[model samples]
Target: MSPAVSPPDARLPHRDARRDAVVDELRRLMARVEGVPKGREGALSFGLSALDQHLPQGGLAFGTVHEISTASEADLPAAFGFLLALLARTPGSAPLLLVLASKKLARCGLPHGAGLAALGLAPSRLTLVETENAAEALWATEEAVRARAPAAVASAIGGKLDLKASQRLHYAAREAGVPLLLLRPGETESVATAATRWRIGAAPGAQDRFGLLAGWRWHANLERCRNGEPRAWMLEFDHATHRFSLAAAVADPSLARGGEAPSLRRTG
Candidate 1:
């Protein structure tokens, strides 16, 4: 007699059951890896109540890496400016470590002392680390984060960044209870473990009677955020306050002079 064989239709139930088991196991593993925060103790507020509400734990979480990138090459300056603003918002007075690749600096130019001061980050409180390449820059950033010396760490490394590298940095930040800010110019998607990812573009700034731009403005997109949905906002930086506010709400001389303001629309 021929060995008994299950018919294709009969095998369907077993296959379906196995698939469900695999899916359930995968979900459990993901949950274990992406552990939820216990509380809001490490949260860093954006100072905007509405923005804070959109972030996980009522604000940007510390002890994790937050990636910042530009919407395009042209927006690199805007993204860097935004990163400085965030550094100014870090909760402590410890010196900030800023790691930059030589190539990136050569291409984008160096961070200006005046600009840093304008963002409320005193140039004296920042430590600069120049690396030969992206890998070196990442290594320096990881070291700074692990040391737990800086109030916050930031790196501007433009080149290939893999998921594993990003995860390593994330783990270091978490272990040291420090926040790592990664500036990925040109906006690549290789970074996987960041607590949040922001994509920025230059927004029309408030102008004076002579058409000179005032405070920095950017169209920011929260592309990826854990525990929160993606959102976009036109934000303007208040140099004196080291805070962010809606661009439409900022007092614009042009607006007072009958210039139409940008619409505040919810975008992706």
Candidate 2:
């Protein structure tokens, strides 16, 4: 087998000094053994074979944290749509963990069921922990990361996240090695401690006599990364095939680019 990147040898919290040492060592090993290369050098496909070919390492870092948010309802479609494709790629046969900070929103299930049907995590296989508060949700996220059985863990939370809570979640996710996706509102702009932070927008899809059909679009204005940084691309998510195909520059008119505009079917 490929050599193990994380030894499973190091213990948690690593006696203070050892903590940074351990994180450093983990980064060193990740450089050598990682499935996802740092930065835009890789395409960041969600595990679709057709999708993987163009991307570096064929998929994203299995357990790293990737932050996501939209500026307004106008942008929510793209953000949520990108997430669906992401979840579609991540739902390996292993149980998946999804912690919903907006249980009342109910949009959490798009990926939980209909979207990721092909990824091996049926709705039944998904374990969702619902909470009303950020602090409480962060606690459960830590537990999920420790479990490590889930192929991925995601949280759809609105508004700014507490810096300390973000850091705690980062370390927990680091130990478990489960990739994380957090959904935040547009107005909220707390600097993320995650491996990478991204923004998503909506794209106008094909339309008939009906109103314009819009697809989800994504951009990578990475706030932080261990790898290289590249200019952002507004990606297109094709719902029919559950694929995240790339598009050119950042101009898609289907989605009103403004953060305050609303654009979504009331599936929630």
Candidate 3:
């Protein structure tokens, strides 16, 4: 006679014991493979050289949930600056959906596509979605995440996301494997469901201001790294040639491991 089966649980479903055994065996067989699968991470490269180095494989992972929050107002750029660069490099830049709850982007246009059309990104690729409230915006943002084909999804929503909603979006983001750029509001101390959490602080400007000092600074911190610590760093975005790179600000022998660079840096 066949083995008797049990009923399913309310919270967690129960499957047949024999079926579970088969799944366990299959998992073990797969674990002994030569190497882990080199799954496709969304092609989200940073236009800035300095910023990409800190991310996974020169960019954020396509399949992971990334939370971007700011500790201070001045540091807000680090969170969105990276997103701007990612959008510029994401494949097929048109139809970029920007679901924003807060009015940061509404008030302050994206630096890449603002003041003038000099930047390569035309007005068409930049689509903005402003909702009536945070709840509506979050729903729309989740929908955008499911649409995954966009270069990137940047949403500046209020810091009132419930855990269940976050989990749903996180699952969708992981499944779709799209780069979700969430702009967490300032002074938010709530928990986040992100594979990586980074806090960015703007450094000084990169070029001379008519008759002033030069260069912009950014302090990036990998607050939560489910992967690994990797490396935490600050960068200098050189505007003369329009290139972003690691800062050589300190030269105390220990931190000067990169050696001397040419007098002038070439930017793109």
Best prediction by lDDT: 1
Task: Write one digit per residue (lDDT tens) for candidate 1, span 160-235.
Answer: 7888898888789777777788888885764888878888889778665798776678877787787666776778
TM-score of each candidate structure, all chains considered together: 0.77, 0.63, 0.67
Compared with the true structure, the alpha-carbon lDDT of candidate 3 equals: 0.59
The deviation in Å at residue 193 for candidate 3 is: 2.1
1 or 2, which is superior by TM-score? 1
lDDT of 2 by residue, 1-268 (tens): 2444665645433554666577556755665564333342232355445334322234555556677776456676567656656765664477767777764245533344554554223677678788888677777777788787777788877656778778777766666667777777464575466555566665555333576544445553333444533224446655556555555343343342432323222111
Q: Could you give candidate 3's per-residue lDDT for residues 1-268 as a string of tens digits? A: 3444544455233445657577556643442242212364343655555446445445666655677777576556565665554455557644777777765544555454662132234556778788978888888878887876665677777657778877877777766667777777684654366667766666665455585645556665556654334334555555444345666664132453332222112110
Instruction: Point out where model 2 deviates above 4 Å.
Output: 1-44, 47-59, 103-112, 115-121, 206-224, 248-268
- Full ranking by lDDT: 1, 3, 2
If the candidates were sorted by their TM-score against the true structure, best first, what order would they fall in? 1, 3, 2
The number of the candidate with the highest TM-score is 1
Model 1 alpha-carbon miss at residue 147, Å: 0.5
